[model samples]
Target: MSDMANNDLEKYAKALDNAIMKYHGLKMEEVNDTMRHLWNKTYQGTDIDGIKIRSDVEGGASKRSYNYRVVMTKDQVEMDMRGRCSAGQKMLASIIIRLALSDSFGQNCGILALDEPTNALDVENIDALAESLVDIINERKNHSNFQLIIITHDENFLRKLGQAEVMEYYWRVSRDSRQKSVIERQRFR
Candidate 1:
């Protein structure tokens, strides 16, 4: 009876591992595809060719954890992005990963909200983010429930994003004299 139980437990573990591997493959494909699309549009002349997600298993057979790292391919050489990339690059990668995760798992929700997405991004990267967002918007325009909500204090970034979306007006929220929140619709210049 003990041997039978051990065999069953091993089978269960193998099944669970296989399932995890399958999910990991799907996630990797989604992330890579998203990066390919966004990176090309964001970085025009940069030597960074693309990025790949590397996963490693840690701990013993009974207890395992997966560690993922973003590796950049430049000049046909691969480099890990941890502690080696600039702040803007890291921010861009973070945004891309979020976008990929949303794309893979949030299809039913149909909404993506970004708060202070331009933080740590340079002027050029800000514009690139706007363009990438516009591309995403266009891709999801056919979905009736898809909506994007962006909250930021940077009016310049908002203007750039509005231009990308071809919007004429945006809602501005501010505190009134009595310290109450007021929402107003303002035309984008």
Candidate 2:
């Protein structure tokens, strides 16, 4: 399966945003600003906060290649540097989803399934990610609708989240070729 399907981007991003806001006690506007800043710095000119995004790709038979240009806020952000630029776009998509969720259904939503949220993030970004997740849980505490199942191999990262009160359950999974993955749940005290 894809790292993240396009359809699910909005949902995931919203969850992420809510998590961040809840943990930090930040306003929705602050979350948006932070997300936009991260996206701009990482993509180096890409404007994900803008209203629309447009892309174009070019290639040939002898040599396969592409030229991607994203137009947002009436500004043209072009990437002709080297490799596939889709990765950056995907990251941006993830951020966008988080922002959208926090802006809309943050109060009503209860559960979130996050698969390797820090896969492409740097050290700083990872720290930010942790803070964001914690914030979401805290913000939704009164509603008690927030539950998170985060799948990752990063022990340290998991530890950070485990510190939160809302993280009530933990599960470990082991897989063998002959059998399906087995899940063991550990209740947090």
Candidate 3:
């Protein structure tokens, strides 16, 4: 990786850590330490299963080439996410990544969306996710005009949101017996 690319990745990682710390009350370094534990595998190969990877060139006047993948020593580990993560973990990871990476691109991404966040989650995990979501929204509420759009069919998840003071809008979407969709929007404190 070139200096610029590495810098960008580090910036994103830092932003992710900071967001987790602010919203979840986690220390960035400690969260990084936890993620270190999560990465259990490492490799020093030019390609993944014989597929070639792009290389970066560097030198003063004459350029030299090196493979970005040809180095590994406990720096990071790959997350076999689909295989290892539970449904709720995957859901939460997706939301957290989306929120964190968005800031890496845009300064103030006003809107963050999640589709069917309660999908595949048990009742307990669903409530835990709702609590985390509440914390995230509360943390961002005072910063600027931010929005959290959660599209879920679970009535229990809605209930976990409690009254609506923390919510700017409560969108209740449903469908008739004919399968026609309807959307209703209401304001909340």
State which candidate has the highest TM-score: 1
lDDT of 3 at 173: 74
Give the best candidate by lDDT. 1
Candidate 2 lDDT, tens digit per residue, 24-93?
Answer: 4445345445555444443333333342222233453334344433334324453432244345455544
lDDT of 3: 0.54
lDDT of 1 by residue, 1-189 (tens): 999999999999999988987998888788788877777787543857877677888986568788989998888898998887777787788888788778877889888888888888888888888888888888888888898888898778888877774566789999999999999999876
Clashing pairs in 3: none
Winner on lDDT between 2 and 3 is 2
Worst 10 residues of 3 by lDDT: 43-52
lDDT of 1: 0.82
Off by over 4 Å in 3: 1-79, 176-180, 186-189
Give the Cα error of residue 172 in candidate 1, in Å.
0.7
In candidate 1, how many Å is residue 9 off?
A: 6.0
Order of candidates by lDDT, top first?
A: 1, 2, 3
- Tell me how far the alpha carbon of residue 41 in candidate 2 is from the true structure, in angstroms, after superposition: 13
**CA lDDT, candidate 3, residue 164:** 35
**Model 2 alpha-carbon drift over 4 Å, by segment:** 1-89, 92-96, 102-107, 164-166, 176-180, 187-189
